[model samples]
Target chain A: MAKIFIIDDDEQLLRMVSLMLERGGHSTRLISNPVEGLQAVKEDKPDLLVLDVMMPGMSGHDIARDIRANKGLENLPILILTARAQEIDRETALKSGANDYLSKPVTSQELIEKVDELLSQPNQKMMPDRGVIIGMFGLRGGVGQTTLAVNLASALRRISQQEVCLVDFSPSGGQVALHLRLQLRHSWLDLPPLADLDWLALKGNLTLHPSGLRLLAAPQVPQLATEPSPEMAAKVIDLLQKQSAFMVIDVPRLFGPAFMAMMERVDIALHVLTPDVISVQTAVQLNRLLEKSNLKFKQKSYILNQVQVDSQIPQATVEKGLNARVASKINFDPNQARALSQGVPLTLTSAKSPLATMMNRMAEVINNRVAKRSGD
Target chain B: MGATHFGRNQLIHMDMFTDAYRVTGRVLVGAGGIHAELANPSSSFLELKDAYISRIHQPGEIVTHYKVAAFSKDNINFIVLQDRREGIPVGTQHGRSIYTRGRALSVFLTVPSFEISGEIMHDGKVAPREILVQSVGRYQLVFSAKALASLYPQISYSGDLILVQKDRIGIFCLDG
Candidate 1:
């Protein structure tokens, strides 16, 4: 029987859900308080937690935030149950670290299915450990760095269902956690100190999403910057594949130890650029920087972000100026940016957006690239 | 185990704007009133500093408490009371936007909520004349104020921007 913890301030709702789970042949613990719910997860370490979105004291969302911060119990599957049946509410719950978001008055069958789905998934350790390392870099801010990185990773997971890890390298300006609306307590900086590089130690630092994606968020604090040596990053990527299939690094534009080292071992470097002159200029400069590092330039591909919009520069003009064939182009959707700032990916927020389709298409190209590279 | 609460500190730790309080009261006028009496540290307009002024009203969840830096001679920084949270509706389906802009691209958000038609603005003016909400959410609004010029030195420059919501008013600080 799966041991589940239900946290909610509503006694009636909690009792109903708990009884439902119990009837479903599962052992359940119900807590009506956020603090107690957190404590239950930490001390009891249940298989899953059914959290309430709105709580009188500390909210389920707040408690989830604390749980993600608590490295020990960070991996616990959280299913948020809320009365606020709004898409933004679901997105908020997901971004706040809930594995599954179910509105209040959920059907007994659906709850059971969600619980079973969460519990049936094999533990993190049971998964296969192999993947590719792709680094996505954008020279300018608002060039859709996090958007591209999150969607690319999701598309990869959707197509191959393989292991994928998305690393947010922008420590100072890092929005990966914010973009995903992940209420993580600790980031890569919080990884337990390593005596030396090992697979288990590195795996401990990862925050796995219910979507089969793992994330290594940049440190939220600027002072806590951890620049893994190129050797260390390469080693981490190499070892992470044992647990993950593909590792995508959202490389921060800031030139430093981490960026330099990650670019060195990146199997494919996807340089993100807009049609703007400033973006192209930065892209060219970044391309040159990558070249000077002696990393294979031929493996690099240019992606024109915001290509669907009426840009200040024409696509043809940008192509002629950069003199590089664009590998892929993603459409511009204001809704996408709104969704992201509101803390949800395009795929999760609005699938109808053209950005989602392009990202999916881009994922196919990358998959083929990986296949070709593996063959070589 | 069935968990219960003892109601001792049930409402503890809900202070979102202790540093910068949230105010949703009308613009009070006092003749040289003391800073303590006139300024509600909880006012949302108090947090306006070097921010981009806009007129666009997009509804979303917002933080109510605004930190008061300094008040103008009239002992007023803004004209209206403001709600901390708003909900803008998404597409035909049920969803909304939740975000607040700070100086530069800094968006100050604690948790993003989904709703439609955000905090209503009865009638008021937003600075940077160009500011106007393009899309409306449950509690959030998308406003455009690119045409409005920056605020010049004036009385009651306490709040950076002002937005009128239904029965409630909001003073804001929007970043470009």
Candidate 2:
């Protein structure tokens, strides 16, 4: 449950709001004065702050403005409570630093809904500054990174408008097409010689999606020659940026020119692992290899793809062994395999799916980073 | 890039579509006083008539605080006026203009809305100027000018300017 702090002068209103939040399964800390509320926030550092506009000593607006001005609390989401619903007043409150403004006499339902919305919104604090690139590979085979990748991309798309490119770079096991259930139109192997590849040709080569996104599928052929080189992969990334924005390269697990080249461009490298010890051991080796490369992936970690709710290896052990944050944990869902077999990204086909939601959150953390960097 | 300044606090600039007939200019008269000078090309000779600030907010592409004015006969009597406190929505203002049967220009606060016939007025007096007068209530006015140039080719320019005054409002200048 999330921790919430309420600041208001009205005793009745404070009690009512506190009760409302508690019923929603959230912990609450209420303050009758604005000054004390600000002090509590600095000292206690609650997950969320609900501020009342009309308060004793200092107004909610003043307290909110102060919190926003404070470098440490600037990113904290502040819900301003006001009696006036005037357009100018709301606009003024927003300009001062409030993330959201509400008129007084607000219903319990509205308060809870607003609070839930604020909390669900990935804390701007948790947002990573760079796209965390996760590469999924199986111990034996068919571990399902393609499905995870597509669904993860879709989930991220829903959260924000950042452009996401899903690259089917898997050399032989390139099943992104099979997972998305979309017929493969073109592949890197079909690409014109690297010398001739430009923005126009790149656009013409990659299918422009109706969703205003782009995808580069891996060649369907098996064991064919003329794979894209590391240099070509770098060039493709450059060209991809010109065509769209963020990219999710479905890199082959086996190391090669393409894999090494793509790794160079990645900001956050995520190695997908499963519940098995072998998979975990493989992830450890991969992390060590990555470190040998001067820790190329700044925040490198393994995602327990298709992890069962009751896994043999506890999350703590995995985190300690990997020496990296678990980053994200996707519990096994019955529909996950079905979603993949049906060739649909879980995020789009079954957004309500629990596994899909987790992946989407993961993507959100990554997308937030890209957005913050660009915003900066 | 062309920009059309809507009633104060809204600046619309056209940098999207490419066309020679694009509208570009800043309304100098806004707030409580009028002080408009053509910064680029250094001169304005257009005239306007039946100018007024509307209280309506157009729903679609054009979001403007309209300034409707009649063109003087020569199209060189440039008039600029400021309506600082008059608050009007686009729909109501446009509806009122329609009821009054006035030729109105929908100033797309984000882009240029009108094309002027050449050799327009530069001074703020020659063109008919509509000044919105009110401190906290709705107000609108019309000033008519003679048709200045009926034979000149039609030209369009779009630009928005920030008007600094006692009251903040978008400014529009017209030349006949």
Candidate 3:
């Protein structure tokens, strides 16, 4: 049973609605005045609020807007019940932060159904329990960024029974679908407009991989001009966060809208760099760019990917050049290229490989950090 | 049961009480209005009057206010507007009134019969039952006639058919 608050000016209607809800197995509080209702909501914080659109002084829309603005009651589900019964009125009620709207003289059955629908929605208050987004960033290509991202995501999926999502935000087309060998008839390009993308749309666009990872592959034919905007990328991340327990994003080298958007929401950014002069120089510039742009991450870990066995630059030299300590060193593995050629992640095919073991350990560290953040 | 009180003050004797019709889902009425209730099924046909229908209906709305208006086990009626006043006035030719009034119109209707198959709850037990329900666009449960016929076959229905609302409807799917 849930606690429901009904705020309507009509005393008789309030009594009727309360009686109806109580019979429906919910504990309800009735407040006729909108001001008192707001105060009561702040004090009690009911799970659901049934508001009336037209009131004596304060309208339901204003009350809903105020409640939404309040940090404490931001996640409260609000249903607007009104006598106005106009298209504009319903739109305004939703615009003012109502989850749903219904006209007055609603039958008892309709009221309960709407209430059930609103309460059944996943509450924003439980968002901390949702997935954490980990982004892989490489200032320059060929640093084994996609390799790390794929293995990390696969490792995370293996570590937890929860769902994992891998998104490719590469402007030059992502290799996630190819690496996973996922045959896809659709990509993010097939999705409806960003404004119209919902859970179903997002789910429909994803291609399921055999490794139990959901992949939002990059466009088969890269279109930089038609790439998702920053806001669109943020919305996709937000939507994906709701469905998966861990999201591993393979971001492109460019710091454009999509890359920056993913950077903004990433809980942890793994800065992948090779032990090479050019890569180290690019990492330093990227770090400086992050500092100047104020695109903050909860945690940033510098990962040194030694793609070559005999490296000209040493780990110490790379660290000194980047001005950051290397958090993890991924040794060059000869089987990595073979694994990529076979369209399988090294972590999946060679779980006992040294590179896979290191990736799994990194995944564990990231998981622990996410758990600690959520607990806090 | 002797006397039962419903709503706030309405009361009726057990003998006079008719089988209750329960609304199973949120049925959209007019544009934004919703009609959901539990009450005795209408004895006769449900009427769509100017006053009750006006509250939910709006002018220039895409969805018709009274399409597939009444449903019975035998047939469903589609309301086709014959004439509507366009809010225009004309000078009297020879003392006879010649003006167009608003909000009044005639409709041509045809009742097409259909078969419905579904289940209902009786005495806390779900059983498969088939009854003819009227396809009224007003309520979510369009099985108006069949719902009444299956639930209360003995009760003589009179006046407008009342839609029976149920609290624990196990399965109420309309197949025609």
Tens digits of per-residue lDDT for model 3 on A78-117?
9898754445456567677777788766889778767765
DockQ of the candidate models in sequence: 0.02, 0.01, 0.02
A112: Cα error in model 3, Å? 60
What would the per-residue lDDT of candidate 1 be over residues A1-376, giving only the tens digit for each residue?
6799998876887899998998766899888878877887898799899998655456677788798778676567788886444344565676676666886558897787667655543233322224667778866877887778898887788777777888875656467777677756656665554456587676777776767777887765566444655565656666776666677888877776667777766666778888898998887787687668766632566777884468778766777778865656565776775876677677655767878876765665456435433432
lDDT (Cα) of model 3? 0.62
Better of 1 and 2 by lDDT: 1
**Cα miss at B61, model 1 (Å)?**
57
- Listed for each candidate, the true contacts retained, as a fraction, are 0.00, 0.00, 0.00
- List, residue by residue over B17-70, the lDDT tens digit for candidate 2: 111111112223322222222222234332222121211121111112223332
Q: Give the per-residue lDDT of model 3 (tens digit) for B89-151.
A: 112346422221112112111111211222211221122232212222232222112221243
Name the top lDDT candidate.
3
Off by over 4 Å in 1: A1-130, A192-194, A221-226, A307-309, A368-376, B1-176
Model 2's lDDT to the true fold? 0.53
Better of 2 and 3 by lDDT: 3
Worst 10 residues of 1 chain A by lDDT: A120-129
DockQ for model 2 equals: 0.01
Q: Taking the tens digit of each residue's C-alpha lDDT, what string does model 1 give over B9-74?
A: 111111011112222211222221112122334443433321111121210122222222333223
Order by DockQ, highest first: 1, 3, 2
